[model samples]
Target: MDKSDITLERLRSFVRVAERGSLSAVARELGVGQSTITRHLRELETALGVPLLNRTTRRVSMTDEGARYYANCLQILRLVEQAGDEARATRGAPAGTIRISCTAAIGVLHVTRLIFAFQDRHPDIGIDLSLTDERVDLVREGVDVALRLGPLTDSSMKLRNLGHSRRLLVAAPDYLAAHGRPAAPQDLSGHEGIRMTNVAGSDTLVLQGPDGARHTVPFGGRFRVDHGLAAREALAAGRGIGSAHRWLVDDLLSAGRLEVILPDYVPLSVPLNMLIVPQRTGIARVRLLVDFLAERIRAIPGIEQTR
Candidate 1:
């Protein structure tokens, strides 16, 4: 085997292709031509004198040997990155790109502002923020950290509980004028409820009463949306009363565009968590940003620390 033919770039290309299962996707991610990715794969395979990836027209699958090699390559790349991080940390301010993933609405409303402030404070550190509602695999996607809402199913990653996202029942003034306001939990049954199609129990609303009792009521509407922004827009447009994260409609509430419906009754709060890849947690930039976010996120208007 020609050991010299195996390079870091080739290993990275191979790993990305293996994880993403698309040569073209890897090329786009790395900002290189597809031919470059193909050549790197070819050279790496030639050096090892074995076929690592089985390339079909539709998809790329790794051979048994390729899977093992991919694991090793990931470790090698992480070690290399950590070494660079340590070297840079010792010299001065933490300087490196930290990739972060967050839910779409939170990203747009609060996290983006926090990130901007963070960057201003530490100009040397670079941040890459990806906003998506879908839960992505951090290790596979090369994401350093992720901010997630609701309970996390995966326990393998390092976790920090920022707090719970406070939710409120809200409606526009005109909506209340037309449908009449709900005075209590049961009053909701007679009203049209704007629902989220993506949430698990969109048809049912679980609210915690002021006296600490739980109330489960049927929630349905003619209009259903999958995105928080869309739901906020629907509420603002006087579509119907709906549950919203306090941060999502805080501006509207302050501006009197939306009013709290049955202020004493509240929807069940969802957990807000920060998840970090085990290997990336110790990197200087990653650690710094995590700390920064943890502190800042707690201060958001609608975020409250769990007891």
Candidate 2:
């Protein structure tokens, strides 16, 4: 086997193809032609003296040897990338792409603007932002950091607690005028309830009173949504009353499009956290973005810092 013939390019192509299970898909992802991907695989296999992939017309599967090699390659590539990151970090100007993951609603409503500002400060740095509500594996996805809402499940990734995201029950002024404003927690069930389909027990509204009381009220309505932005829109349209993160509807509230109902009561706050891949903690660009985001996110309208 010719070890010298095995290059980073070949390893990267092999890794992408193995993960995607489609040579053509990997080709498009890498912005290269299928022929080039095929050649990379061929050369890699020749250099290793092993058949790496079992390719048929429909799909590609990794050989046992390929699977083992793929795992090792992931570590090797990560180390190489880490070395590059550290080297760049030591220079005068930090430069490299930072991959970030965030929930779609916050990404669109707030985080994107912060990212734009971050770019303004560091022109050489590039950002690859993935907007999704699903929890993604940062290492598997090659993400540098992720801004996550609610409680987290994974213990492997490093954590930075941003704070609890404060929430409130709100309705449009037009809706209030048509349906009558809810005077208290009991009055909420009589009015339409715009609940989240994604959240567990969203049909039940839990509010903490200013007097240190917890109110559990049955909540339901004609409109149920999974996305935060959708919930904000529904509230603005006066479809129903629902809980919204303060950051999600601050503008509408300020504009009088949406009004807070039951001012004495507040919905349960969700935890907002930043998760970083263990290997990326020391990278300068990652650290810069992480610190920048933490500071900016805390300064947001309804983000309450935790002790």
Candidate 3:
């Protein structure tokens, strides 16, 4: 028989005999009889074309050839162990491509940065991101992970709380200085406002004032956009006083390009969540990406910290 036909059982028996130096001792450890151990060793020796052991009635030892063969077997066994470890490591690590979807505004403001950080840590992992304002079916679209804002409607998908973002009424410093800032929620009626439409085509703004009273402001603008990013760009260009997630305009606010119109009347913080299909929960790549994004989103400036 060729070397490929040699059985691991025979190699194990030879190693046991070489280590114990006695057929009876090796057989005892292997849970086999002494004759059985001798037969296995003979089979291995026959396959290798080399006598592997020096056998005697009083004692057993390795011949010169047997010593060399045992040395080779030891090296092979060590290599086998190393190969098994590498396989296990690949299975546990995040190494596959993950599909993700998010709104254009959030994607540009937050998700894009997190994706870059995740890629830096796991270079082997590929990320496919689809940015749109439309509500996408996670399973139908074949998305592995999704970043969603506000309340979620689909109960079938698994949701993990990432953090929360406050909707702030903001305007360009020039616009606010020219038209003057609204002193109260009711004052927005006389001021020019910008509105964003969701998939449902309805728009509503809710705010919580310093007096601990919740105010729902209902208004329509001369200009309406379907995406937050477009609405933010319009607001930055001095279109009108627009409301957007605080996280999205953090840089603009910090640089004095945009100013919070109503500081005392801040809107309610909307929960931001990471949604994943239930079937993908156990997948190593999906789980790793979800966890990494959750931690990073929570650290974003102006967003509520998650516990």
Candidate 4:
């Protein structure tokens, strides 16, 4: 026989029936209707041009040819199951290079550490990180995932919202000593403020009090930077007070290198995002990296929630 018409489903049904020696039992075990099993067996026998089972009123038994065919069916089914398992194992284990693009300062301050942690869990996965102030064309740049920390516009790319981190107005101890720390959100307008020219709404700073009260203050200074790393360096040098995310200044705050502006008021919360191509979201490696990132990044000390 050419065997072209014999389907894998038919083979599995025939094998189960032969092994169990009862069509009804095979149907119950497989959770399929008895008619389905019977059809599969009938089609399989028709394709082979021979009766594979000898049926009586009480019991069913395999003929000589049927016995030989059962042996072949078991071998084929085992091979097929092995193939499926191998495919699943490969998908389950992420092992490939991922190209990532992100803002320079946060990438250095927080994202890099997270990447190291992810690599520790998945030793087979490799990451290429590109830190820049300019927006990257993920398609042309071949970036698998891009971590963005500011406002988002309409895009065809898929975005996973990790969480929102509040911005804290911070300045070096030296700068605070020189300028005198702002006691309230409105007081920030009087002091020299480090402004981020690259982000929208940079000129106006919004601060939220512990009581859920909110207010806006105009922020400007002699120092204007488009990049956060540059601004961080300037801030570290005691240039001017600037609002930064918790992740960016966690170490500095812990080490007493920098101090918060209005302890009672917090700056606007910025959403952390991971952008991926719409079509590539289902890829095993990409999906694994995103899931791992979401889990670890949300666990960072000051993150609010993964919305």
Candidate 5:
């Protein structure tokens, strides 16, 4: 078969199998039999006259040729998507599935409501929201847009600053009353500090002290929770003073369930960002999601009011 005869369906199947690392997984996603996926991969490899994937009983991985071909395929797919987007743009309404990944707190407090409202406005557009605290690989995860907080280390992705969120040190009022408030960042050493673990097993906490000096406190605790909601609940129950996104604690603070400690020492503000993979940014669904998120996040009262 001629190389030009390789159909987009075959390319898509090959990419999916490579990304998911399993033909069975791809079959599950595509709602087809595993043998169908294998046939597509075989046809694609035959057309290209290259061994694209090393298939073994234990695992599946891309060969060097497969890696190079997959990269080119992604570019071609993105261009095709952009062409479709250009066609759709003239219709004056955005449509198609927008896959978004975001942290749990932002997903719960903001993204969910915003997506609902967006769907109401643009009924033609479909949203696929994935909420996790783990840092996702946009391309590998098949995400069109990602809502990320704090510093962005991925130079390959395009980042648009949504706004800033304050990292606050907070404790339940009862806990503060009994243990006394931390007057300084150093005082935290004397108190029970609740720590949150990310997917990579790293802990992050920021403290601002009476002297207006910022300190990033990395600590080990008797309890290490992975979810923001769990940490917030523990803090509310006086388990320990913990650090949280200001918006996450807004209701609790207003209800006097939690109180800010060392108000003068607030951690350095972290900017919330919307990121898109460079190759996919021009795609209609991806562009639409990024624009929608940027506008919605900018309008959030909690994020907007933060200095």
Candidate 6:
């Protein structure tokens, strides 16, 4: 086998597909098409003169030859990354393309804007951002870091607790005026609800009162959307009362465009975290971005602010 035929891109594709077992997912994460990933794997196999994958319609796995090659490929890639890290470290400047995955809603309202500013400050660093609600495997997708809600029940990614994201019930003034403000948590059931697709299937909203009492409000209605920002927009447009994250609606609330429904009752808050593979944490760009995100995410309302 001639070594010159094997390109770094082809090797990367083979390794990622081997680890992920899905060309389609790898394509999405790499911002490429499935055919491209398939071609890369095919070319690599032809150059090396061996079948690297046992492929089926439902799944993909490495062949015996592939397994041995995979270990070597991993070591080669690690060395490449190490070289990049060492060079960047010697210069005391972090520069590289960082692929980031995050949900669509948060990406639109908050994360993307911050990324733009961060990019402006570090022009040498490239940002490859993917906005999707579906969960993705970071290592297989070649993502350097991700912003996700925690504590995740099943994930090995190392977590950095950015802060907590608080939930609040909010509605437009017109909607509240027309339906009448809910007198109690139970009253929320009587009003229309703009449900988000991410949090669907559960009709109950379990909240804690100021005095430490728990309240479960069963809710559902005609309005439902897959994106949280859509739900927030629908609520502001006088669609119905719905739960929203404080970071998302703080400006609207401050401007009096939306009003809090249950002032004394607070729904459970999820931890806003930065996730990265533990092994990759030493990379300078990844470390820089993590620190940048932690600093900026805290500046968002409801993250470090008192109610």
Q: Which candidate is the best by TM-score?
A: 1
- TM for every model, in the order presented, reads 0.95, 0.90, 0.68, 0.66, 0.87, 0.87
RMSD of 2: 2.3
lDDT of the structure predicted as candidate 3: 0.78
User: What is the clash tally of candidate 6?
Assistant: 0
Clashing pairs in 6: none
**1 or 2, greater by lDDT:** 1
Ranking by TM-score: 1, 2, 5, 6, 3, 4
For candidate 2, write residues 1-307 as lDDT tens digits.
Answer: 8888899999999988887788987788778999999999999999889999999999999999999999899789878877887776677678889999998898998999999999999999999999999987676566889999988999999999999999998999899899998888999888898888878898899999999899999997888888888888888888988899999999999999999989899998999999998777877788899999999998787999997
lDDT of 5: 0.80
Better of 5 and 6 by lDDT: 6
lDDT of each: 0.91, 0.90, 0.78, 0.80, 0.80, 0.83
What is candidate 6's lDDT per residue for 143-223, written digit by digit as tens?
A: 778888636653688887777888898999999889899888988888898886676454678889999989888987898
| Clash tally for model 1 | 0
Cα error, residue 81 of model 2, in Å, equals 2.4
Of 4 and 6, which scores higher on TM-score? 6
Instruction: Please give the clash total of every predicted structure, in order.
Output: 0, 0, 0, 0, 2, 0
> Residues 195-254, candidate 5, lDDT per residue (tens digit)?
866634335455555676657755455777888888888999998888777878888999
Give the range of the ten consecutive residues with the poorest summed lDDT in model 5.
199-208
Clashes of 3: 0
Which scores higher on TM-score, 1 or 5?
1
Put down candidate 4 lDDT per residue, 198-294, tens digits, no spaces: 8888888888878998898898789888878787778888998998877777878898998887788888788878898654565566777788888
lDDT of 1 by residue, 99-199 (tens): 99999999998999999999998899888889999989887687889999998998989999999999999999999999898878988988888998889
Worst lDDT 10-window in candidate 2 = 135-144
Model 1 CA lDDT for position 93: 74
